[model samples]
Target: MSSPAPPSGAAPTPSLLRPWPQFLDLSALSLPISLSEATYRLTQNLRYFLPNYVVITLLIFLVTLVSRPLSLILFLCIFAAWIYLVFLRDEPLTILDYDIDQKIILGLLAVMTLVALLWTKVWLKLLISLIIGAVIVLIHGILRAPEDSMEDSPYGSLLNVVDSPGGEHASV
Candidate 1:
């Protein structure tokens, strides 16, 4: 036998397990053509966007905290390599050499941060990493004297030679 239909004019009941609608129907979401319209839409969505922005900011802060130790270790390793190259390796020095090394370290730290965010939840790990990074930078800055200074600089010998009259005459 066929079941009787609900009475006319009554709303249909949604599924008990899934009370919300299935579709967001955002296919009509399009970029606004005019500046005024864009501003209006942005203002209208501020309530929705604000909470999401706050959540994202909090997550980023937590991730930075968690991944700080790894960042510090990477920084220290890079800093050690720099010192070795500049002081002991007898390598020819150039401004770009240090710049390139620093960039590589930063890139590695970024990757480590991303990995930490994905794999870990411990805040202690991140805090340690951050502390390590800060220490490495501080130490490196203190040890790595400026190259341009004529006196008491890492490149002082080279500068002295260049500044001496005999050296300039010899070069001419």
Candidate 2:
């Protein structure tokens, strides 16, 4: 039976994800016909949906690390320490009234990384897990339908993440 159409004032369909609908548009997923087509789709989709891709990769990385509590904890600690100390900190780090140099912090990070590798099998697992994440992201980027203009892409109109040409995203 033919159903009646909705009123003109009706709202549009809700997104699969409220913040980003295009992130999981199963209807639009497809395989590229050729290498050049795949490359074009990948480049365009990566620029158009980079934030979604990053979130997916991070979720996969964290989920994989969950099976290894020690590795997860150690990795998080090292990452958090580096972020807070090097990027977010407004004041110099000090120990025993001695100002710590950035070089020293980097050295400590390298030593800690070596210890993490030597004392555990984290190196292999970490490499495999992250590579899996990146592969998944790359696959998504290549499979999603290509957008000729990133600014006119679905999410592009909803969010200003991708600025118009000659704007903040100058490269785009």
Q: What's each prediction's clash count?
A: 5, 0
Best by TM-score: 2
Which 10 successive residues of model 2 have the least lDDT summed? 11-20
Clashing pairs in 2: none
Residue-wise lDDT of candidate 2 within 1-172, one digit each (tens)?
3447869998533211224665777877887666866777788776666656655655665577788888778777876776567655546688999889888988998898788767866666667767987898788878887645345444445335434444454454
Top candidate when judged by lDDT against the true structure:
2
- The digit string of per-residue lDDT tens for model 1 on 59-146 reads 4444554446765455445445533443343224347555335455446656765665556554555456456554543333233222
Q: Please give the CA lDDT of all the candidate structures.
A: 0.44, 0.68
Where's the lowest-lDDT run of ten residues in candidate 1? 15-24
Candidate 1 segments exceeding 4 Å error: 1-28, 69-172
TM-score for all models, in order of appearance: 0.24, 0.50
In candidate 1, position 29 carries an lDDT of 45
